[model samples]
Target: MEGFTLILLYLALPSLLFSAVKQILTWRKSLGSKPQFPGPRQFPLLGRVHDLPRYSLWLKFKEWADIYGPIYYTRVIDQTFIIVSDEKIAEELLVKRGHIYSGRPQIRSLIRHKEGPTYSALMDRHDIWKAQRKWAHAAVAEAYKHHFYGHVEREMRRYLGLLLLDPSRFLDYTREYCGRVMSRLAWDDATQGRANGDSADTTLHCMSVSGPITNTITPLWHLPAFANPWYRYEVRREREQRDWWLSNFRLAKDRMRRGELPGDTWAYRYFEQVKKEGNGDLNQTEEQEVFASCMIGFLNLVGVVTISGPLKFFLMAMGLHPEWQKKAQAEIDKVCGGRMPTIQDYAALPTVRACMKETVRWRSGVPLGVPHQAERDDEYRGVKIKKGTVVLACEWALNRVPSRYPDGDHFRPERWLEPGWPTYQEPLTRYPNFREGQAMHSFGWGRRTCLGQNLVDDETFVFAAAVLWAFDLAPKVCPRTGEPIPIDTQATNSHVILEPSPYKLDIKVRNAERGGQVLEGYREVMGELRL
Candidate 1:
C-alpha cells in the first residue's frame, strides 16, 4: 500500500510542480510589470475571457477600440493579445518591425497539420512560409504577364450574361462571378471550366470552423486536448479538408498528366514555380506536398469566395448612396463610351476605383484581421509585448480609427478624391490606385501580408467599372409604400467575413448600346469556350 502511494505521488509530482511554477509566474506577473496598453478590465488568471462574445466578435473589438484607445490588449490565461485599431500602430509594429512581429500563433485546436504542410499564410514564420509567399507572388506575376486580362474578361462576360438574363439574382451571380473568375485563374477550368464546388464547400467548412476561435479577442485556442471542446470538431474538419485536397489535387494533376490544363494555370506554376524554389525538403510526404500545393491553389479560391464581401458592401453602398453611383457611371461613360469598361481604362476611371475602395472601408471583409504573432519580445510605446503574443490589426476598428475616418460607418467614395481626407490623392488617374504599402489596410500589413493582392485588385476594379458602367444599381421599391426599401448591412454568414444577407437590388441596363456590347462580349466568349 505504501509503495502504491509512493508510485502515484511520483507520477503526479511533475504536474504538481508545473502548476506551482505557473501559479508563481502568474503572481509575479500580477505584482510586476505588465503590458502597459489599456483595455477592458481583466479578471485574475482568466484575464479578459469574459469580454469575448460568441458572434460578431469584430464589433466587440471595435467597441473596445473606441473605449480603450486604438492600441489595447487582453489576456486569456497564459496567452496574450494586442489589438491595433490604429493604422499608424499597425504600420509601426507590423511594418517597421516586421521581422519580429510576423510569426503565426500555435493554433493546434483549429489546424491539424502536424503531419503535413499547412496553408501558406497560416504557416509559422519559417523558411517554407517565406518560400511559399515568394512563389505565390512570382506565380501571380507570371500569370498576369501571360494571361491576366484574359481570365477577367472571360468571367466578366459570363457575369454580364447571367445578370442580364436574371437581374434579380444579382447578388448570387456576383458571388458566382467572383468565385468562377478565381476558379479559372487557379486551375484553368481543369474541372472542365466549371466552378469548383469542392473548393467552396471545403473553404466554407474550414473558415466556419476556425472563425469562432480566430475572430475572438481572447482566443482560448491554446488549450490542451482534454480541455478543448473544439478538438473533435477540428479533427473532423481536418479530415474533410485533407480528403478534399487529395481528391481535387488528383483530379487536377490527372488532367495535367494528360496535358488538359494550359501552361499558364496555377497547377503548372505549383510545380514550375512553387516547388522549384525548394530542394524538395519542405514537405513531409507526397501527401504533404500535394496539400501544400492544393492549399496554395485553395487560398486563391478562398480570397475570392469572400470577394463577395466587398461586392455585397458595394451593392449596399450603391443602393444607399446613388450620387456616388452617378459619379461612377459618369466616369465610366467618359472613359468607356457605349462599350463596357475594361482594365485598360483604369487610369481614367478614378471614381469607379474610389467606390470600390469605399465598400471595403465602410464595412471591411475581414474586420478582425487575422492575428499576427510576435517572434520575439518587443517593446512598443514603452509597453512590453512578450514573445509568442498574438497581435490583431482589427481592420474594422482600424478603418474607424477616429483620426483616420471621422465618419467611419458612413459610405462616402468622395473621401478618396478630397485632399483633406487621409485617403485623398492627387491626379485622379493615379491616386485611386491599389498600390500596396499605403494605408488601405485591405490587403493587410507587414512581411506576412498577402502577395496576391494585385490579382484581386485587377479583378475587383474591372468588375466595379464594368458593373456600374453597364447598369444602373438602386434599392428595391416597397410595393405598398412606394418608397425604396433600405438595404440592410447585416451579414448572412456566421463567419468573420461580413457578407450582406441576400438583398434586393434594382438593376436595369442604362441603354441599348451598352446592353448590346455586353451581349457581344458574352456570346463571343461563351461560344469560344463551348460552354
Candidate 2:
C-alpha cells in the first residue's frame, strides 16, 4: 500500500510542475521581450483598465492622440490596446497591411458558446468568418439590386397614405415603414406575402434572432457571487426567442430542401447554394462554415437596428432645425420638378447628399470601428503590438479631429462643396460618412467593412428624399407654453452602435400640391414595382 501511494504522489508532483512550467512559458510568450510602448504606466497585472474615461473612450483616445501622437498603446487587464488615431496610421495598418492587422479579436464567452458565436464581429481569422463575409457581400448585392426596392416603395406609399388619412401617428408610421423595408430586404418575396395580411411571425423570428442578447447577458457572468443572479425571466425569454428563431431558420432550410419554400432571401440562397455545392453531405467543419455565412447575413439584415437609431437622430435634427427641413424641401421640389425624387434624381441634388453626409459625420452610427486584432508581432514607430492584441481605430475621433476638418465641432455641409476641402481635409473626406460619393470606414475597415453599405445608402436616399418632399418637419410645441422644444444632437447612447435617445417630433404634410406630387411620384414608382 505504501509503495503504491508513493508512486502516485510522485506522478502528481511532476504533473503539477509541468502545468506550472507551461503556464509560465505562455505568460512569458504573451509578455514577450519586445520593448514596451511609451504610454501610461499601469499596475503589474491590472494594466490601465481603471484609467479609461467615464464618458467616451473615443474622446479620451483623441485627447491621448493629441498628447501621445497618432500611434499609441494602452493595456486593460490581459488585453492590449493599440489605437491608431491618425488617418495615415489607419491606412497603414487597416488598409495597407490588412493581412496582418484586419483580423477581429477572439472574445471569451461571447464567441465560444453552446448556441454558436453570438457576436460575429469578434471572430479572429476563422476561415468560416471569411467565407461568411464573402457570401454576405454577394447576398447584399442581390438584395439591393433585385429584391429590396419593390417592397420599399410599397411601404413608403403605405406610410404616406396612412399619414394622409391620419397624421397624428406619423412617427409610428415612419418606424413601421423603416421596419418593413428592413424586413423585406431580409426575408424576400415571403415578406410581400406577409404585407398582404399574412402572419409575420416567421419573418419577425428571423430578425429578432440577431438581437444583442449575448451582449446584454454576458456582463452577468462578471457579477459578484452571493448577489441575486442576474439571469432573469427576461433574459431567459430572449434566449428562448433566439433559439426559436434559429429553429425556424432550420425549418426554413428544411422547407427549401423539400421545395415547399423557395430559397429567395440571401440567407436561403446562400444555404441552398452551400448544400448544392457541397453535395448535401458536408463534413462538420464545412457545415459550421456554411452556417457562419448564414449568420453573417442574418446580422447584416438586422442592420436596421443600426439605421433606425440614426434615422431617429436625423428626424430630431429636422425637428430642431425647421429651416434646414425647409431648405431640403426646396431642393427636393427643384430636383424632382415638384415630384418625389428618384434614384435618377439623386446626383443632381448634391446638397441633400451633403446634408446626409454631415448628419452621419456629426453623429455617426458606429463611433468605434469594430475592433481589429494583430495576427502577428508588429510596430508603428516603436509602439510594440504583440500577437493577438486588439487594436481599435476611433473613427469618431478621426472624424472630429480638428486637423482633418477645420471647425470640426460644428455642422457645415458647405465644406463638402469646397474643392480645396478634399485637398486639406483628405482624411475626413476619404471616410464614407463625409463623402457620400465614395465608400468609407463608417461601416468598417479592411475585410470586415459593412456589406450593407450600398443598401443603406440607397434606402436612406429614397426614404429621406420621400420624407422631405412629402412633409415639412417642425418641432413639437409645449401645450402650456406654446414654445418649440429643441433637439440635442449629442443625446445618443452606445452599445455596439451609436443611437439617439428617444424623443418626440411634429410632422405635417408640406402642402396639398406637394402631397399630390408625392402621391403621384409614389404611384408611378409603385406601378413600376408592380406591387
Q: What TM-score would every model get versus the actual structure?
A: 0.85, 0.76
lDDT of 1 by residue, 1-531 (tens): 223434444544554456456756866876855647898887765576556765567788888888888889887655689988877788999999999988877553446432235567667766666666676778788776654747777788888877887999887777767766666666665232234433454445445423534323223333455544455567776666566656655566667656676776676666444346773422336755565555655565565655777877787788778899998888788777877777788788878888888788887777788778898888888887889899999887878766777788888777887889876877887767555524557777888777656776788888888888788888899999999887668555545455777788888888888788888888888765535
Where model 1 places Cα greater than 4 Å from the true spot, the runs are: 1-24, 32-35, 113-116, 146-149, 190-230, 272-285, 288-292, 490-494
Error of 1 at 524 (Å): 1.8
Question: CA RMSD for every model?
Answer: 6.4, 8.9
Clash pairs, candidate 1, are none
Candidate 2 lDDT tens digits, 310-366: 566666667776666777778887778665666566666655666666667767776
Look at candidate 1 and tell me the lDDT of residue 391.
Answer: 94
TM-score of 2: 0.76
lDDT of 2 at 438: 39
Return the top candidate by TM-score.
1
Q: Rate the local accuracy (lDDT) of all candidates.
A: 0.70, 0.58
Clashing pairs in 2: 432-440
